[model samples]
Target: MIRLALIGIGTGHPDHLTLAAIKAMNAADLILLPRKGDAKSDLLDLRRTICAEILTGPTHVAEFDMPERAATLPYLDAVDAWHDAIAAIWMREIGRHLPDGGSVALLVWGDPSLYDSSLRIAARLGSVAIHVVPGITSIQALTAAHGICLNELARPVLITTGRQLRERGWPDEADSVVVMLDGGCAFQGLAADGMSIWWGAYLAMPQQVLIRGPLATAGPEIMARRAELRQAHGWIMDTYLLRRERAAISRDAPTS
Candidate 1:
């Protein structure tokens, strides 16, 4: 039986690793880390650092080249195909390393329940006993670094992707939205009348950057800074939460 553990490691920060995640890493028979080309070598480096600090058992570490998604297909379709390819690569690696199928672990960036695919890939393993060790997420770090609560009292929060925000615009009833995986500043097109935004890039890491204020005023600044940092580092992992003001909500609502 394959005992698979999906361990959340957070945004490349050594401190962001939870004790549970560290334990899980040490318990695994094999650990797999994917290299997504030279542009994101930092990801592999971070995994290596984590392995150095945590893996105590006789665990074998392996690196596999991650497949890139084709840009020609529809967005969802392309992502689905990419994930399939990733699952195949993982299967190949696991078979090569642990033909007997023992305990294995993959260190995921941020919590697996969030915008991560490690858990999904593990599900494709079939009949495996799966375990999830939760760790801090980029959203958690974003809120903590900004020193703000995620949602207002008695309000619901919607967590979504950059693509959703850009394509659908703001949902009618959402007062607070946490946007992740946004390559473009989707919040810029938002009606920023009285909405406040808290943005952070590289959360919980040494190279963290933050911006917060009324969206109208801070939007451009965040966009400019995001571009600068992305150019400087060649990659970035960022998240932001936007809360529309009560007054602005009332103004946007039509009178009955």
Candidate 2:
């Protein structure tokens, strides 16, 4: 049986690695790293740097080129096909390296359970026992960096994607929303009135950027900065938290 461990290495920061993540990396017989092309070479390099820093034993490391998802297909269909392709690659690599099946690990960015598809892809590998070593998520990193709470007292917080926020406006009954995987500044599309935003890019890394204030005032600044950062780095990962003003809700409420 193949024992597969998905170890989360939070936001490419060496210090963000939990002790469990470190132990898992050292314990693995083989570790697979996906190369996402030249534009995102820094991502793969970050994985290499982490391995260099913590790997104590002779664990074989392998790198595979990632398959690009077809942009022509519908979003859901494209993602499903991409996951299948990734799973195939995983199997091929594992077979080539560990024909007799032992423990193998993949370094996941942030926690595997949050907006990451490593777990879903691993499930396709029939009969493999999966283990997860949780690391700090980008959400945690964002909130921590800004020194704010994730949710207001007695209010529900909705964690969603940029696509969802764009297609469907702010979710009803949610006072706070955390947006992830947004390449474009989707917040720009929302009605900025009565909203506050805390935005961060490259959280926990040396190149981190943060902006927070009334959405009306900070939204444009974030868009401009995001473009600059993406241009400079060739890639970027960012997330933000938006909270609706409680006073505005109270003012809009109809008297009983």
Candidate 3:
């Protein structure tokens, strides 16, 4: 049986790796990196940089072209199909590199438990022994970069995707919400009153950028900046946390 290690690398930053993640990389018989054309080649480059910096001794490395998703399908359907395709690709790669059933590792961006699909794809391999090495997540890096807590003290924090934020608006139960995979500027849909936002792009990386203010005041600025950066880099990964301040009651109130 092929031993698969799903190692989280975290937000395109080499320093975000934990000691366990590094050790997993070194122990792997094969390390597979996915290439998504030139525009996103920086992603694979980051993976390679981590290996060069951390991995010692001779270990096999494989790079494979990533499959493109069908754009005609609806978003969820498209992503589902894409994940299926990726699983197939992964099986092929593993078969070629580990015909004898040895340990293989794939470097994932951010923690696999988040919005990432590596875990789901691995399940498709059918009864393989899977190990996970957790790394720093973008949410953690985003919060730390902005020097803010993830939630109001004693309050619940909701972690969600950009699509959910756009469709459902801000959740009623969560005073604090962390948004990820937000390519559509979902924060703009929120009612800004009493709300504060802490935003970061490329968190924990050299090109890191950050913004924070009342959502009403900073929403437009963040939108504009996000667009500019997306144009410059051809891709962007960003995350943010939003919280609402408690509203004050009227001075003249009826006593019970």
TM-score each candidate: 0.96, 0.97, 0.94
| lDDT assessment of candidate 1 | 0.88
- lDDT tens readout by residue for model 3, 1-256: 8999999998887888898998899999999999999888777778889888988967899999999999999988998899999999999999998888899999989988888899988898897899999878998898888877887778899999989999987676777889988888898887787788899998877778899999998888899999998889888888889887655112222358
List, residue by residue over 96-131, the lDDT tens digit for candidate 1: 999988988988888899888887777776788999
For model 2, which pairs clash?
A: none
Q: Quick one: ranking by TM-score, best first?
A: 2, 1, 3
Q: By TM-score, who's the top model here?
A: 2
TM-score of 1: 0.96
RMSD list, candidates in order: 1.2, 1.3, 3.2
After superposing candidate 2 on the true structure, give the runs of residues whose Cα lies further than 4 Å from its correct spot: 251-256
Query: Per-residue lDDT of 2-83 in model 2, one digit per residue for the tens?
Result: 9999999999899999999999999999999999999999999999999999999999999999999999999999999999
Q: Which has the better TM-score: candidate 1, or candidate 3?
A: 1
Which candidate's lDDT is highest? 2
Using TM-score as the measure, name the better of candidate 1 and candidate 2. Answer: 2
